[model samples]
Target: MGVHTLAELTTFQVGGPIAALYEPQTHDHLVETLRELWSEGEEPLIIGGGSNLVAGDEGYDGPVVRIAHPGLEVVPAEPGRIVLRVSAGVVWDDLVAHTVSSGWSGLEALSGIPGSVGAAPIQNIGAYGQEVSAVLSAVELLDRYGEDPVWVSADELELGYRTSVLKRHRGEPAERDAVVLTVEFVLTDAAGLSAPIAYGQLAGALGVELGTQLPVADVRASVLALRASKGMVRDLSDRDTFSAGSFFTNPIVPLAAARSLPEDAPRWPVTPVAVEPTVIPLDHYTGELPGYAPTAAPELVKLSAAWLIEHAGISKGFRLPGSRAAISSKHTLALTNTGGATGDEVAALARFVQARVSAEFGVQLVPEPVLVGVEI
Candidate 1:
């Protein structure tokens, strides 16, 4: 394709033109294409759904590789569980729908998240009460410096609160050089019952207790409805839906910083889960025992990013003087492209929000999307 328009490729619809584009639909083809590009001294920008991405208006000069595989394989597993090997190019929502329809119970709560399955592990995408890491088993990825694709266990990805080692920080390359080709999800067959409801809003909508488990399909429907209410689920006619979901991740700050906010502001304790204890045989144990260790102080707290933006004086639907980019009318966390918005305009709006939040609370807000050529 000559002079591909990146605005049409990304969900934000804000990028300019691209000189080279490569769309690969199969595993071998993608690997071969990357090999050729690498041999030519080209480090192509790889893309999945572009749902959580923002590209600059000037556009990119390098080659672009868009993963578009459409394969979904059912792996043999023991009874009471299901293993699915999905192509990285498969749309995430479709997979969720399929799982729900097939009575697979793990991914129902993660229903409306945008992007392909291949990109899911990069950010450990989560919503409602469920996250991808909860169901993910492993990913087959190609290590840039290695020869062929290899399966890496989910634990190796270092999944944590909307982040993973596979994800980039501040426009930098991912710490890991691997590019995901396939994702394996291990789902449960718990009589088709959904996972326990963890989100308060979701529980209220479903008319159930916080730990209640409903039918998997019911959970998927409720999650989709919840996302739609926030302008999260895509609707072509709704510009508010034309966003990269939450522009900023919920900021995790020190407990001291959180205490500085208003009394009514939403604040949640951030507790790190204890790792599994190592086991030692009685015969292997030495005579001397270790000394008592003090417990780590609870110092980190998660602050609501939306609340910070609103308290900083930016409201939902807030727009710059002459820019088409604005905060979502339905959700303060999202910055939307209200038709014909340039990448620079969105970036400006994002920077303004970040600056305002920082200036007000002395806490820096970080962008959540994978920005390509766009700076915030």
Candidate 2:
């Protein structure tokens, strides 16, 4: 209904007050405001849970449209499939918990991810080998360039690992013009059976072979517990949960580049051409050349950013001199505000980590959260 500061909305608790904040109670009001803003040449930022953003100390100069539009309707579109049209403003984790409690099988593994449903497709949120894109049927969007609300198929989103067309931009302003209003997902009506377990840890916890099915509720519980242990779950009391989940997307490097590492480096396949390695650093040690040399080939490899941070000698609770901001003591990836920290302080810690990781490993780490008025 009205405006609020970034410090009032975001989990980080460090941004300056926003210029304007709007929470439209209905879709029609949202469309009208958006259309007016677009016609007037205003580019408003669409905010959801404010969990995945890093607002600057100066805050946003533009209008901040909080997507509070609400609706959740389920219709049986076909046998064994239920079409769920979820409003983008719905709290994402709440929806997952609801669906699992109702015996639905699709979103159990995504149980504890913070943020709103509307923001899910913006990055195709994924974890534990299951991605929101896998069950996504279509998205309802308010087109910035056009006058009407349009329904875009999943194919239109160009969904991939932690990315979508909305995020890529592709040299056009189309992404900025589009605001997701609602999302549709196709879920199964299986009697308590969950989607096939794909992540190794989940499989081991369930005591089943990879790709085996278990009870949907069990999968949701296991996923939540796993995330909490990593400080991924949002908890205001715990400074570790102040982060925007994992700070970096796993680096996808070429297979040849992966092979150049010592025999002890851990790796997993992203594709036939790419392999992702655990975050451990290979260049921490200064030494003479081995039998293998670093390759220049364009093979793709995915490396963990957290592992690189630990290897760079930045252990948990790492602080810069006398700063109040420090890395989360529970998880290496999270940079937390231990009270009295400013946006600049948080950004400083992030840059320090990135610089150290890159210097020690020869690999650059890209931040996962969207930055407001600061650079890392």
Candidate 3:
């Protein structure tokens, strides 16, 4: 096979070409390929479905490794629990559809998301009040900075709001430089019943009260419909779908900072983790041991990025004078490529939105996509 351009592989369709592309058909082959790349001192970019990427116009100079290991197996587990081990390359939606059709319940709410199974745990992908972290049991990953692959529990990944130890932040390397080879999910039989509905929008669309449990198939259909209406599901005819889903994550800020926003602004409480202190020897202690107690601080609040963007005076469909990229007409959170848009055009629009929102609300919006050679 020939080397393909990043635009040909990604949903955004705006990046430059790759110097080389390799798709390993099996898990062993994938591991070997990665080991070889690392041995050769090539920091190859590992791309899954390319749904959450924003590559720069000036092509990637390194190798592009694509995970192609495919298939799923029902692992033997405790009674009443179904453990599904899925290969990294399996299409995410296909897995959702299969599970729903087979009467499995846990993943029905995540219906139309675009990406591979391997990419889900990296960001702890969530929507409609459910996260993959909730169901993920373990992951098989090949450490880029280590000598071999290993299976780690989900808790060890430190899955949080749209982030994981495997995800690289703006200015820091990933805590664990690894490539997910497979994922194992522990789901209940549910006997055809769906998990309790949690998100208000999903509940309203399903005509059910929050916490109500509906049929798995019904929930999948409703979730898919809701996503499509928001221009989140992919559609070739809709330019709005030509985007990296939500461009910015909802900002999580301290309670005081959140309260400064207008009363009409949308906000949700985020639970905080407690920090433990290091113990010291009694003999090495200072003159007096300090008496201390850990009291819970005000809960963090997650503010809506879309609300800030809209209230900041950037309406849906807003675009720069010379850019083909524009805010999605159906959703304020998305910045779409209206055919032939370049990476710079998308970056410019994103920067414009960030600037406007920050200037108006005093809140800095962070992009959600993984940028390759593109800065905002």
Top-lDDT structure, candidate number: 3
Model 1 scores a C-alpha lDDT of: 0.89
lDDT of 1 by residue, 1-376 (tens): 7778778888888898877999987999999998888889888888899898888988888899999889999999999989999999999999999999998899999999888988899999998878999999999988888798899899999999888988887689898977899999999998889888999999999999999989999999898999999999989999998889999999888787788888998988888546445466799888655653445554788999999999999999999999999999999999999999999999999999999999998888899988888888
* Candidate 3 C-alpha RMSD relative to the actual structure: 2.0
Candidate no. 1 TM-score: 0.93
Give the Å shift of residue 370 in candidate 3. 0.5
* Candidate ranking (lDDT, best to worst): 3, 1, 2
User: What is the per-residue lDDT of model 3 for residues 240-285, given as tens digits with 9 covering 90 to 100?
Assistant: 9999999999999988898899999999988875656757698888
Task: Summarize candidate 2's per-residue lDDT along 13-109 as a digit string, tens digits.
Answer: 7788777887887878988988987888888887889887777788888888888778899976877887999999999999999899888888999
- Candidate 2 overall Cα lDDT vs. reference? 0.81
The superposed Cα distance between candidate 2 and the true structure at residue 356, in angstroms, equals: 1.2
TM-score, predicted candidate 3 vs. hidden true structure: 0.95
Query: How high is each candidate's TM-score?
Result: 0.93, 0.89, 0.95
Q: How many backbone clashes does candidate 3 have?
A: 0
Q: What is the C-alpha lDDT of each candidate?
A: 0.89, 0.81, 0.91
